[model samples]
Target: MSRLSLHRRLAFYGAAAILLALAAAAMGLTWLFGTHVERRAIAEMEVQLEQVLSGLTIAGGRLTADKLPMDPRYSRPYGGRYWQVQKGGETLRSRSLWDETLSIDGESAPSGDVRIYRQRGPGGTPVLGIERTVRLPATLRGGEAKLTVAMDASELTEARKAFALDLAPSLVLLAALLIGAQLAQQVYGLRPLKQIGRRVSDLRTGRASRMGADWPDEMRPLTNEIDALIEERAADIERARFRAGDLAHGLKTPLQALLGEANRLSEKGDEAAASAIESVADSMLTHVNRELARTRMAARQSGTQARANLAEVAGRVVAVVKRTPDGARLEWTVEAADDLVAVIDPADLAEAIGALAENAARYAEKAVRISARRAKSKLTIRVCDDGPGIPDEDLMRVLERGRRLDEGSVGEGLGLAIATDIAEAARGRLTLEPGKEGLCAVLELTAAGT
Candidate 1:
């Protein structure tokens, strides 16, 4: 049955407990009924014993029994009532004994007081028998005689069997009803979990940006926290976009003046020097364009949510870097499983890691290595290169905006800074340290939810 669901399992347990209680109740009632039946049978036998005793009298110095007032129905064979009297060897019996004489099994019957015993009747029905002995007056024989009374108890057994038969079906029906009610209650109780699943699905398909606040008390806090994270990401993206635009606007006038001066020098001849100046201006424009592109990319991805597979991203970045002129000569290796995922924008993660790979390709003598692992709630990505390591004093300063360790190098001044900015916006951190062989850059971000 694939095991019962939580609701059905609880219902089954409840029904089992109820059935146990019902069984206990049935047993108690049956015990009480048997006790009542036994007491009634004994009482009836005592009454018959008293009637038979009353019939005894003494007359003419002889003991004799007068006409007894017992019901005639009790005299019939197998009629469930009987009586007998014995004086020495002489015996007299009621017709209800049906040719079966009552045997005196006790050593001697007690006088006046009645005693009860169980014996089998002619028809094999269990019977309750009461016996008594009494002495005659002096005028009579002055000896004792025994009298016995019995009644069939087979009817009491039949009544008990019928009672159990009547109760069995009722207990079964009650158990079934209780089990059904428990299952229904469980289904209703879990309805909120189902609603939460649907809301998450809506968020995944972009139908909703946030799971708004109208939820059950148990789920409200979780939903509110998710909404707050979405809002925070949106604000970070907006701020990055504004900064990029402002930086671009602030640099336009100076770039224009540089181009105008280069153009004026070209018009005055000395063509070779003019060409050199134009090249510098063009290089400046190219670097500005790359910076603007990086900023726009970062801004557009502000609220871009994705599960970044660490190994896949690293592998893809390495493949692209391997195609570059300098990257082609460097050995690349990735060490992480594909299932490791981080909850961050994939493009931002790639760009951050890609900047580290580019730096490695530029300085590494032989190999560039990447490794990723999950620690507690965070995922850490490390890129290492077998190149001249950064000086300890410059490690932290290297990530500052517009700073470059090699001032003679062109068109690569802000790579680390731009990557670090993207990581910061996603609530991640970046670090640079001396590797075993050379240099290592580490990026840390939150792990994705399964």
Candidate 2:
């Protein structure tokens, strides 16, 4: 789905709300004006009825109404007000009625006072008729009957129209002011979001390393998270670059030694000895390739992830080793919890644990013990064996690159050194310590915060 821009959405919603409020206010004003006009028209009509009633009289047993005092407003023809009177089905209307007779619908009203509504005259003007049954001096009672007084309502219609016209401009002005205020509020509220976008762009262009934590409280968590991700990616890249350079440097000497040996063998003119030397050089090259692979793996695995579980890695390594002839006869015990984790890559941790397990299998009488525990921010994994432990003097020496205590062992002296190098790159340490009954190797890595 396509997304609407924030500014446009804000403007739209603001306009809608303002329009709704204005419409409600306009309706309310219209209603109130209409009510006031109606009340005033009724009051004027009531006054006209009273005047017409006062003018009533009976002369010679014939009822008659003289020219009543009228409002100046209804003096002209169709000037918006008019009056009419009816007696015994005969009607008398103002000149303002314009030669049209007043027509009232419904039956004749009852005695006392009654109000009858009608539309009358040529213009079909609204009329309110007030009727009174009169007993005129007993002598005229048989001849004269009821009387009605009415006034036209055209003035109220004009007043209502005028009110609408006058109120329209004010309502429109209020709506405009409200819309402007809403727009201003939207701009002010979104200023912080705009700033955040600009800062993100700056980071992409390398103009800034982080969005400094000076943002509003609502935005602080987002800024901090972005900074953390950037820092983590930078650290990963730096470690990869260093690992590549170090691996290249480490391989150069072995490759040079192999080339030198080949050159020497070619000059000696001893075919069998030269063949043996070539085999040794090939083996050294193979070992160098393995170490190079290990370095690459280590570099790829470095990240700001939670640590690998030491007990889990040790169990996996031992399971694999159990298939081997020497490993089949050995006993392994892992004392760490399954949930225990360290701040190291799982693959790197597995490799380190594998190396220690294999070494223990090679030299141990029967059993090897792997344990993990946390101290402060560091997690330590110790691998102990029931075989002859290293002497105190050589314990530190065994950790050196290409140095092995047992010269009789096959393969290049790289397993321990490779594991140790990986640990160091991960900001960890590996050390050899004298065990109670054998050698104890300890791998210490930082623990990720819970």
Candidate 3:
């Protein structure tokens, strides 16, 4: 399933909640309006009932409407308002009745009591009726009679429908405006997160060193923490580099002392003893240098990245290697795109690639080649030499410190190991493979942005 963005998810759920609330409110309002209209209609019927009762009279044990109600509709035929009086089986109806009758019978209306209900009337019109029982004058009959006043209920129903029709459009417009405003609020609220992302990118690319201030209070704690972390990291890297340099310099004196003692033995004509002591001292010095180089590389990797030109770093290494005794007899070729860049410190990158290029030049019989390229997020550097390449079985071993394939090799086999350590600390890798004519040493790093 595809994921919905924050704005979409909030908008969808918020809109749904609003719609539900409006629907319920619309229903409640419709019902209230209908109920109010009904109550008002009942009040109006009560007035008509009073008028009808006040106009009644009794003569010779019979009921009479000497005067009718004042409502004009009651005088007209099929009028929406009507009245009736009933005693024993005889009936008196309004002229508006027009041969149709109100159904106010079969229910008790005790003396001085009034009742209100709904019934069909003249012309099958839905109507509300109020009925009351009254006592005849003592001068005439000795019983009670029923008088009812009714008004059409269809008009009330029609009014309710019209109210809903008018209300629908206004509610629809309100819903649209509310949902639009909510979406705008979400975009405005989430903009801070976007700002954080761009700032962090700038930090990684060396364009910015810290997350600046003036952020909203909600984001201030986070931004402050990130700024502090970057500062602490920079300080830690600097301290590590200083310690590595100091350690290397401190060990140099002791190793030189060992060499000096070996020279004294050689002067005394004990050549075999001198050679053994000198070889051991030289191996220890090489190992110390390799370890120090790795320590410095690790420190650099923890700090902010700097954009380094792949071609520039490789070219400097090749130029220096060409001046060496082994490279002087070989044809050296260096190739790289001028614009190729990697997310690595320039000095660290030079040290790593320089080791590989130097090894290639030292072993090559006829030629040495160095090349570099940037492809998307990956930057690749290769050093190839026309040398007696290590056999496939020994290629992996060559990457381990002090594991020389040829015991007679001049230096401790720590060059490739140091390069591998540097590459791995930089979040990259180094691999050695046999090429068409020699061994090709591959160094791959992540490229910086354009």
Q: lDDT of all predictions, in order shown?
A: 0.77, 0.73, 0.83
Question: What does candidate 1's lDDT look like per residue over 1-450, in tens digits?
Answer: 666775556666777887788889888888788778878877877776677767766656445656654677466787877888888776667777878887646665557777777778767878777788778555546678788887776777777788888878987787678767766776787787787788776565343557888788889898988788778877887788788778878888887787788778888976777777777877777578657757665564546455678888898899999999879999899999877888766767787788889988888999999999988768888999999989999999998877888888655466788678767766688999999999999988877752
Report how far off residue 36 is in candidate 1 (Å). 0.6
Q: What are the runs in model 2 whose C-alpha is more than 4 Å off? A: 1-4, 73-80, 89-92, 107-120, 123-154, 202-450
Prediction 2 TM-score vs. true:
0.47
Ranking by TM-score: 3, 2, 1
The TM-score values for the models, in the order shown, are 0.44, 0.47, 0.71
Could you give candidate 2's per-residue lDDT for residues 1-450 as a string of tens digits?
549989889899889988998888877887798788777766666777667667766676555666475676456776555666665666666667667665566666566555656566447666655655554455435544555555655655676778888988998998899889888998998898999998886554333557899899999899999888877876875677587678778877877787677778778876677767777876777576556656565544433333576777888988998888778998888898776777666777887788777877888898888898888767889989889888899987888877888898865667788778778766788998988889888988876552
RMSD for each model, in Å, please? 13.9, 16.1, 5.9
Model 2 has an lDDT value of 0.73
Model 3 stretches with alpha carbons more than 4 Å out: 1-12, 35-217, 300-302, 328-332, 390-397, 433-436
Best by TM-score: 3
lDDT string for model 3 (167-218, tens) is: 8998899889888888888789889888999988777655566789968899
Total backbone collisions for each predicted model: 1, 2, 0
Clash list (residue pairs), candidate 3: none
